[model samples]
Target: MPVTDITTDAENLTMTLVADVAAPVDRLWRAFTQPAQLERFWGPPGWPATFTRFDFTPGGRAQYAMSSPQGEKSRGTWEFIAIDEGRSFEVLDAFADENGEPMEQFPAMRMLFSFETTENGSRLTNVTYFTSAEGLEQVIAMGAIEGSRLAMGQLDAVVQDLRAYAQGQGTRVELLDDTHVRITRFIDGPRELVWRAHHETELLKKWMLGPDGWTMTVAEPATDVGGTFRYAWEQEGAPETAFGFEGELLQLDAPRREVTTERMSGVEGPGTVNDLQLYEEDGATLLTLLIEYPDKETRDTVLATGMADGMEDSYARLEAEVLSK
Candidate 1:
């Protein structure tokens, strides 16, 4: 289960799980709808299981007995409410006592599983709907959160294995058009040090700019409104290393916050509009850089070149250098 979107409202708890399996939707559906396939990865890992019965159809029931590591046995049941071949299925689940009776008057949960096909593979989503707040609370008290997470982890493993078996290949990273990347570092230094490392030329040279072999030519700062600055970098044994911007200091509110826009150019780009913002938090500073390109193609191209990773590494180095001082 991918567990993509999870939310809780004033009255109900909803969770959506997504998975991209190697096999088609029909195969994936069978694996979920068949009792034998589900028992393989249904329970928490390392727990002794005794699945008393399983009937996969509308109005059917599934009963399972599981024993913890400490030898405590627990039982549960799912009443199948609806079924859709190769598309979706819904069930109402609850805990059962020793006599196979529901102990608590909890709400009936409806879990719907849907499958869709993509060029790369299949997309499977599991949407779970809780009836009421009290029903959601009752499951939480029974440690449902952790249990559900463990179940999803198991499901992911199963999907990975099935995909590998079906495709006769290993897992591959699929990059989508709309992928967002952000990095954050916690620096144990004065907020001023971190702030200056980005804004001041002298301080930037100490950390932001690379070592001596790397020549940082420009050191211009416009501290007021409409002020412009640019810095050029060149490495000794490498091609002319250059990435700078010609932009205005839209706002400079001191050590607390600052915002700037720059039109960057060089090896990485012909030109890109960049916006940077800084915020102070708990004696530390949080810096955010937002790059806006002319189009999605440009953004995807930049991302493919690992620019985000490079930026993250540079910021990590800056954090270490600032704290060392």
Candidate 2:
């Protein structure tokens, strides 16, 4: 286990766990902040976690559930209280219901995670503060210490696997559920630049072109909530083969996340909801797009269009044509 020490103080009503990770602070931070990576080891060996929602900014909330082999589920919620980017963060952790609301019978705890460079690599100091000594004892009696140790023990494999989440892996797609799909691409650029490339007309025109023979004709982009945008692309010298998309921004959190409704230009009825999130670590950014379709048919139909391959082409162009320059 990576956890070197586990201690409790009844007088202060706190429990502290110190772990030494064999990776840089930035890598460790990414493993925790990114939902794709966090889910791998958030729970103990048999119980695996799935994060339904992860908003890493202050005042935001994360909801997750750990499922056991016996089909029992333990739900939890994290209300982000404070964040010092790359260094530390604090959250109100509580046992939650199926809907992710905190349960009245369980007491909430304030947990602080601090990261720092160490001789071997980095150190993680996790401190849980309870309202009373009884609360602390209650958590310990529930096997909190053992569960945490086993969970952290699995961290070594995750952080060392650079090939999984690093740049140059191209676009990856995962079917999250019947109506949800997630796509991820690691960009060799900062978060701000990546976000700007998707919004600024000039930058978008340069790299948003999917294939070598295509050109972007319309590059209108929406950077504000409720604003509409349109984009069209055509093969070189073939205007008749042109296609376009139109969308209205639903939410915008600059340099972090955005949500929009997307559909083919002039199409009516339902459309897909796209949630785009960006996280930067060690000068590189991970761009995650979570798409929610109207149904499984629409989701599968879209994937069958070679969308993942096209996204990879565009992302490669983004690094070479926009970020490199």
Name the top TM-score candidate: 2
Model 1: per-residue Cα lDDT over 63-125, one tens digit each: 887654224668778888888877877888777888655658655678887888877667767
TM for every model, in the order presented, reads: 0.45, 0.59
Q: Deviation in angstroms for 66 in model 1? A: 2.5
Candidate 1 residues lying further than 4 Å off, grouped into runs, are 11-13, 156-325
Tens digits of per-residue lDDT, candidate 2, 1-325, equal 5889999999999999999988999989998888988876798754567899999999999999986533468999999999999999999999999899999899999999999999999989999999998899899999998899878876875687543445566788877568878687888889999999999999999999887899999999996777999999999999998999998887665877677889998778788888787767678887878788899999999999999988899999999999999
TM-score of 2: 0.59
**Residue 302 in candidate 1 has what lDDT?**
70
In model 2, which runs have C-alpha deviations exceeding 4 angstroms? 1-164
